[model samples]
Target chain A: MSAQGETPVSRRLSKIKHIVIICSGKGGVGKSSVSVQVALSLYASSPNARVGILDVDLTGPSIPRMLGLDGHPVHQSTDGWVPVYADGGEARLACMSVAFLLKRKDDSVIWRGPKKNAMIRQFLSDVRWGELDYLIIDTPPGTSDEHISLIEHLSPVHSRLSGIVVTTPQAVALLDAMKCVSFTRTVSLPLLGVIENMSGYACPCCGEISNVFSTGGGESMAKRGSIPFLGTLPIDTELVTLLDAAAETEQEDDKPIEDVEHEGFRLLRRYKATSSAKLFGPIVENILSRLSGFTAQ
Target chain B: MIAIQQPLDVPANAPDHCPGTESDLAGKVDACEGCPNQDTCASGQAKSAAQDPTMIPMINERLAGVKRKILVLSGKGGVGKSTFTSQLGWALAADEDVQTGIMDIDICGPSIPTILGISNESIHSSSSGWSPIYVQPNLSAISIGFLLPSQASAVIWRGPKKNGIISQFLRDVDWGDLDWMLVDTPPGTSDEHLSVVRYLKDTVGVDGAVLITTPQEVALQDVRKEIDFCRKVGIPILGLVENMSGFVCPGCKTESQIFKPSTGGAKRLAEEVGIELLGTVPLDPRIGKSADYGVSFLDEYPDSPASQAYLDIIDRLRGILGDK
Candidate 1:
């Protein structure tokens, strides 16, 4: 299979230890945000683990902006094009997205099937991701061309390729998310678990938790389907604001801060600490444990 | 190649066991090797074997009757593209003389059929093409949802297949002389968007697009890209509709910001993009209930704020299309 026409991509991905794909059947379910947070959490938890995030949501590339690496371009090297690197606390995280190649941030990519397929192929094969512990891919919604292409491209190269289905706590979303679960099963991709995003909203002023769309749908869906339930992420307005601000900040030289005296940054820092401690922390731990179990096997 | 010892004059409607069957000439056409028209006959047979030779022309002829095409698009998913489309169809069909048709191009998660309460009916095909399921006398609809075997079945297809089916929906569906054709596309500026715009614009010029978004930065952020898509493709922007702007409690009737905007909401985004803000729809619980039960909220709760907003939006849209 490596000697086939897909040799370049399969050979390129052969170096990665694990490739985890985050997907959902429905759009606007915070799938991209979950992918970003999961990658960040993985980097924060592992001391020496090398992580890379590949935003394959070509038409709606959000990872570049979400992680403050929007305008960064891909640099060419002898091996291939090197991915852009951003400091993730103690570890360095590599990122790649088609957004960086666009002339404008608002430029829409109106591409057809063959062109998109070629682009995804180039993204997989041309990006020189040097020995990494994890390569997390963020795909657009639905179990269509992009999802099938990614699974087929990565499964032959990496044995540890798995999928994490993201969903909101609504029956409509769950109904579609179930198709994502079935998609993974049909493709024979390993199921890491399911993460229910925007499960509940915690009031920023009074700290009262409200079920924005009803909370237990995701957990029940996971249980009914016999898949592992990762955890639920509360709808944090402060986190949304912080991420938006981070994307807008133009300073490329800005380093990760331990503690800031500025009021807004301080609040952002506090929110990150609390939210990760409460939500993303456990989710990342469960994912890492699953990967470790797979490695052991 | 197999040698053909049989005659070339085979009857078109001959029985299976007839002397010179059609199947016998399939590969045994080597006998016509010296004939001048052999190339033409072989090529014609190949074309016919593939599929109908007039698929594109058939689609063009079918859509030639549609006066205006308005695509309902959004960059972000789950922003109620289908629900809004269903409501807009109902609203437009309220006029006794107006004729409206909806083409659900969201092949993967086709919710239009279910939302419009026509999911149980299967599409019927004629010599012309597949006939659209009529939700009302004046309002007809078509969706991939109606073609599925069951509600649990999923359409796991690639780009080319989806494109082909979407083209068929436009060309093959029998939508005759529609005053307005609302095309509901999947989220993002990808395959479905490109296909719908190409087919509709090439057949009959598209009127424009109606963008939908929520009053949240997360949704508005992606909708900005959608607006960019419309501009790049040369599709005029009719306006933007902000759905679920605020949630109205049924008990207290007080509007509260459920998904508050971190980035100044849709109105600010519209201002930044230089487009008109058509209307804002409050998050009414009744809308969801009606949508789930496959009924029209405007007809059930005409006095509700959300329904009223839809009416206002419909009026503005009619003004733009000059349908009034």
Candidate 2:
């Protein structure tokens, strides 16, 4: 464990092997969900691999809610602020977010540029992530202060800093997603690939895959931008319901329930079987293969 | 300050290309062939000289024409700040006596132009200043969207540049004698929000802010901070607007909670903050289509449940503004 106060970020994050930032130029394209799923999928694929999910979407932190860690406070030790750990069955995933620091789950963070930068810096330097194989950072929409600050802060510490841009298969979303790709290029960050989320919706009753927004936009974007096309995630309402149920159940932790009996727990199990979860398998594999290739270089 | 050079008069038989009318100034044709000041204009140095100084007095002078200023803000993205602003503008303009103008300060994602059906309208610069494009008889707007050469062109600007443009939007745009001026801000409480609140406060004094949020706990959580921001900055919050509260199924008209309020919803949030919950607008598919097609849902579907909710919200806003 690294000592917390006044320690340099590079030394603090030196143990982390790889850092992947999930970002989108446009909001509401399921960036946070993709980040969470990727982190979980990485953990699922390699049970021994240490995964840490950092929700740096300071103003709008949704990773905590999605992972059922909302209202959990970060603990401070002699090492640093300890992140909350979520049990992913055989493997455990550590989580840290600004949402944990707020008094209420509904409290807003009305911070300016300097404040946001400072918060991101503190999250990078202060969190006691320990030695981890992967650190997935979820950022807010656009290439704003958070994006620049995170990249600038991590470039000195982590050489294997890569980015995964997320976008829906819609022209309007792709228009912004292209900017995200361009932003990664301008920053000189290595692009792992692009994930087209909410590409289609599988009707539970009809058993038909309906094109919700549109499909193949992200694949074409990846080809045009010369980045790897990761995969497409379908819009799964069950996943949303599972996330909401988890958040509610976790907030009501006073009443302990058996893991097998918890509704949220059951819903999460069902969520892991959904098409979106299956989509994450290929995306995670692509990201790992790309990272290995980079390491070889 | 640079001295203003008087332009030479056009000859009696010269072509009808004099830069006198609004159309001539707005059009692409250059009519400065024989003018004495053409040299300075050709080099674009005079344009800088004519730029409005970003001072409090200058902004106040420009805002003096507007009777009331309302800022629409949302802490969470995709919560429909631009959609609500456009609808509010249309609803306010529905009254023939009321004049409204929307100033979109969302530099990166300025959806005002597209939402208000004025995406093709060009902003014309005159000797006075830049004029906002009038989308309707009673409604006009100014946005960073209009400044872009194409819709696909992104405004990849940093904080200071965005602040500069927002200040310029308020100080330079010719929004004359508006009964109401609605300032639509980007999601989050960052540079844009601070700039709009600070500028409005120092210049014309903002009436209040209408905070928008969805019913989900994820959105309500951030919106709470927005309210705290208004209080901390000494700006009164008019009320809270719960958008996309429920989804009315078109088949049976049964309202369902699409994005359920895991944290007790906005009504509870407003109670905790001791503010008014203006109204809750159900999720309507047409609303999305309207925004995409640059049409006002309120005008196109006046009988929509969402439109009625907006009308009620507007009524509450009017009550807060003491307009009714």
Q: iRMS for all predictions?
A: 7.3, 7.7
Best by lDDT: 2
Q: After superposition, how far is residue A22 of candidate 2 from its true place, in Å?
A: 1.4
**Which stretch of 10 consecutive residues in model 1 chain A shows the poorest summed lDDT?**
A259-268
Error of 2 at A285 (Å): 3.5
User: Model 2 residue B258 lDDT?
Assistant: 55
Against the true structure, what is model 2's DockQ? 0.19
What lDDT score goes with residue B205 in model 2? 95
TM-score of 1: 0.84
Model 1 alpha-carbon drift over 4 Å, by segment: A2-6, A88-91, A202-211, A248-271, A274-277, B1-57, B248-260
Q: Model 2, range A41-150, lDDT digits (tens) per residue? A: 78766647788999998887888878887778888999999888865342247899998999976565877777898998899888999988999999887766787678
Categorize the docking of model 2: incorrect
Error of 2 at A61 (Å): 2.5
The local distance difference test score of model 1 is 0.76
Q: Encode model 1's per-residue lDDT on B194-309: one tens digit a residue.
A: 87787667657789899999876667767888998898889999999998777655445555676667678888988998999899998765676677668999999998878999
Q: Kindly report the docking quality category of candidate 1.
A: acceptable
DockQ of 1: 0.29
